[model samples]
Target chain A: MNLVIVLLIIGLLMIVAGCWCLMRTFHLLKMTIGIEVAMKAVTLFLVLAGRISGKIALSETFVITVMVAEVIVAVVGTGTAVGLFRKYGSMDVRNLKQLKG
Target chain B: MTILSICAHGFIYGPILVVLIYNLFNHEFARKHFFWFAGTGAVWQILAAIGGFTALNQNGQTSYAFGAFWDIRLAGAAFFELNATRFLLLLIVGLVALISVLVAHQTVDFNRSSYTNLLMILVLGMNGMLLVTDLFSLYVFLEVTGLCCFIMIAMFRSRADLEGSFKYLILSELSGIFILTAIAFLMMKTGSLRYADLAGLGQRISAGSGQLEDLLVYAALILLISGFAIKTGVVPFHSWLPDAYQSADTAVSILLSGAVNKVAGVYGLMIVMQLFGDVAPVGPSLAAVGIISIIIGALLAVRQPQYKRVVAYSSVSQMGYILLALSTGTTLGLVAALAHILSHTAFKSTLFTNAAALQEQTGTLELKDLGGLENQMPVTAFTSIIAFLSTAGIPPTAGFWSKILIILALWQAGSPVLAGVALVAGILSSAYLIRLQRTVFFGQTRPELAKVREVRGSVLTAEVLLTVITLGLGLLYPYILLLLHAGGIL
Candidate 1:
């Protein structure tokens, strides 16, 4: 129980930090990394949830599936960032204002 | 398996088969004849959904559960279930996909094979989302759908497309994380993620089982709501919507606005309501969001110069009505929400189809650059007017009936103020749509646009087909109400 609680606090703090990184970063790749960080924290939460509920097997399956999905999202995000980089000659999010209202 | 089960299974397997067969052909042939493959898959889905709905209704089954080559009877196993609501949504998916295919035939010039492949994958993802019986599976399918959308938005790799796609990716992934965290918290509380297990969770939370459990549940609820709100593109979370819609090709935009948002975002919210509705703040919070989205979406829409941006913002506004109806948490509210979703699918697709037509002919979608082409493109003009009428909830159009049903549902749910506000939003909708119409169609024909001609082929067919659906549903809505009354549901 102590271990689970310790992990929970660590996981949540990681998410907050990840979100902070996501908001503070101007580089497109950094945003993707921030998102990945938050996703990993959620993965930890899933494991912790399983530990609390005595359904580690179920949560293990969920964690694996989520990892796969997160990887795909990362790949797509990075690819889009590359495309944006080629278009704008920089990885800066500030250059992404062409479609504004 | 029985025939109805076979039809249900087809929703999952049909798209896969299309992808396989589409790839079997040579690249050149597949590229040239992509429409037949994608179109047939869409039409098959539509027929299957209708068949499944009718068969399930005749047998008096609320839900039909089946596993895709797996054992659903095992403890804690994930599976798919088909019910009336899923059937309705699946039908919309099929219909919007068909419209997107029709528009794609004209608008998507390069990467035709990739377009067909991605579109099928998108349909598969949406079908999976609709069919899943568990929260975890829903999230997986939601990501599948989101990934397909991001890819399709950036398919052409244009500067604008890449920007829009990137913005959508970041926000969508953030929402995904939110949903995952909520799912984790829910699992911590309930020990399972299945719909059956999660039912009455709100009652359990309100039963005051424990302080920690209650806090966890509340946290989960908040996460789920905001996550799905971002997907639904309502109010403050809607910044990505117009950008994505405006930057993508019109065919892709049609799918984004007409179908994907509803299936991915609104449907997820519906599940949230189904699960957590008994909580004290759930319904009112949703109502507040709904009202804000309606007012702000319209206000933003009125200021856009691009044709697709207006329609996109209008989508945000219309989504608010559905949310408001769903927020009522009554049987009538559910029915009204479904009706509005169906009508919105038809009219919104029509408006986007008109966008395709205008873009193809006038070579631009800027309202300022466009002037009177009413005579030049009579079909597109007439269809646009009908769609505008529906958007404004004018008489004898499907939007009018759906909006009325929504107001009635709200009133019956004892929120007369919301009902009245929804009524007034109809006028606001008209104000923007009229301005849109007057600027693009009713004004004097600019010298540059004087020679613009009507769009032919599949685009025109989509326009007429969607217009008929909007009008037909409106005319038939009365009988539908009577049928529900006869069935003792109203």
Candidate 2:
């Protein structure tokens, strides 16, 4: 039953990732958030795979540390998005035409 | 001997400490601090050479391990190895830092104390990168250097600098994320992040069923390489180089082109290749990218009107040669790559400083506005010629030896066609370089440049120092080769 749920989540995440990859007209902030959702789902998928395989989650400490790092990275990414919006008046990476070569 | 060497090792940390004390005391000690950093760097380089020689003489044997308080592991493992190669890399870091400071004293007009401090921190991080054997430690040092690069470039606070720095930071962040993801995968599979620990994992992955292991390793490699490539400004990822180099003040470009790119990008690629010997499978892929960089970079460089942008694009091409040699993985290839690295450092910095002097004196770097610099700034023009010749790979110059060695290595590796391509690239190098010389130094004086006079002593000293090294390498080719071999890079 749990396996079915995990697979469903992964399938949904893949669909979203494809959509994000194709959305060329969206704001950069939105696209970046989409990437974030996909990444998080992938991590969840890893946890589910380990659980399904019955592999012992060795060292809860390491797992906690990784979780913390993931959260920090996500926060940093959001901050970067905000900064980009402020600088260019839009978060669309396509608008960064000053350096296009 | 161990105690003495260990103390000497700690002395490499002296530059940072000096800066810290000076700042706290509000002392006007830029010159003193500069000398302190240079002196300590010289001392460290001498120590590293001695240690490296002794290790080689002893048939590659050395053992020393001090306390490491911040050993964060990906999967609960510790990696601490001291080797001769690490010592040589440390020596390179020290030498480059020392050279940068000497060059800085002449050309840089920014806040002296802060610049020296940041430079020391960057040097410290680079030294740490060379010393650490663990993957996590590698990442830590990588972040340190990357942050330093961002801060240094954005230090000017110009709109162009900010935009360029922002772009660089974002790209680097993306790459960093991928690297972390790869590290996570490795930890999940092998339960350890120590490089030696990964050796067993590598074997298991290699011998495993299907190409899953191959895909995973390549994914990690791709992430790391892409990140470092962005740092180094290799082609297809070189948009940041010209903007950053052109907009930056003089000292920043010198460090960016000469040191930052090498440490943060090329160093990472070399480390990954050395760690995993299975790079042969992807060797062709790397070679393809390198060839494209060589062709595109040189062609684009010829079309740039700005002097600095031309040098910037040429760096992209020169670094491609470095990447190509690494891809070959032959002894001769490795030797040539290292030789090129050293020679490029000398000549490229000379070019940058001389270009800066021209910019300052004439208030422009546009080739259309410059002419007959040889008669007015004889010293600058002379050094510029030597640097240009060295980079053009003229015979009996350092660049020539390195290029020939790389070609020989490619031939040894059974890629005569690639070697021929490399030769063609060499001709392209000569074409663009000759054009630069004719336009800047040999032509009749431009009306606008009539008021230009030679820059004074210190700037001239810096260029002369670097140009001397560029010329000396050719005359001392055999000894340099021996040094490379002894350095365990060959």
lDDT of 2 by residue, A7-28 (tens): 6356456736734552553565
- Root-mean-square deviation per candidate: 1.2, 4.8
lDDT of 2 by residue, B1-490 (tens): 4543454355345546655755664445554465565446545554665655475447545644433444435444444445545555566666566656665666556556667667777777776676666676676677677667666766665556655665665556555555555665555565555677766444566534665434556666666667667777889888778877876767778878887788777777777666664654446766776788888899998988888888999999998988888788666776667778888888888888888789778888888888888788888888888888888888677888888778877888899998899988988887778888788888788776777888875567678778788888888997866776697654
State the C-alpha lDDT per candidate.
Answer: 0.93, 0.68
The C-alpha local distance difference test score for the whole of candidate 2 amounts to: 0.68
Q: What is the lDDT of residue B4 in candidate 1?
A: 86
True contacts kept of 1: 0.92
Chain B TM-score for each model?
A: 0.98, 0.89
Q: How well is candidate 2 docked (DockQ)?
A: 0.18
Candidate 1 lDDT by residue in tens digits, B380-481: 889999999999999899999999999999999999999999999888898899999999989789998888989999999999999999999999999999
How far residue B191's Cα lies from its native spot in candidate 1, in Å, is 0.7
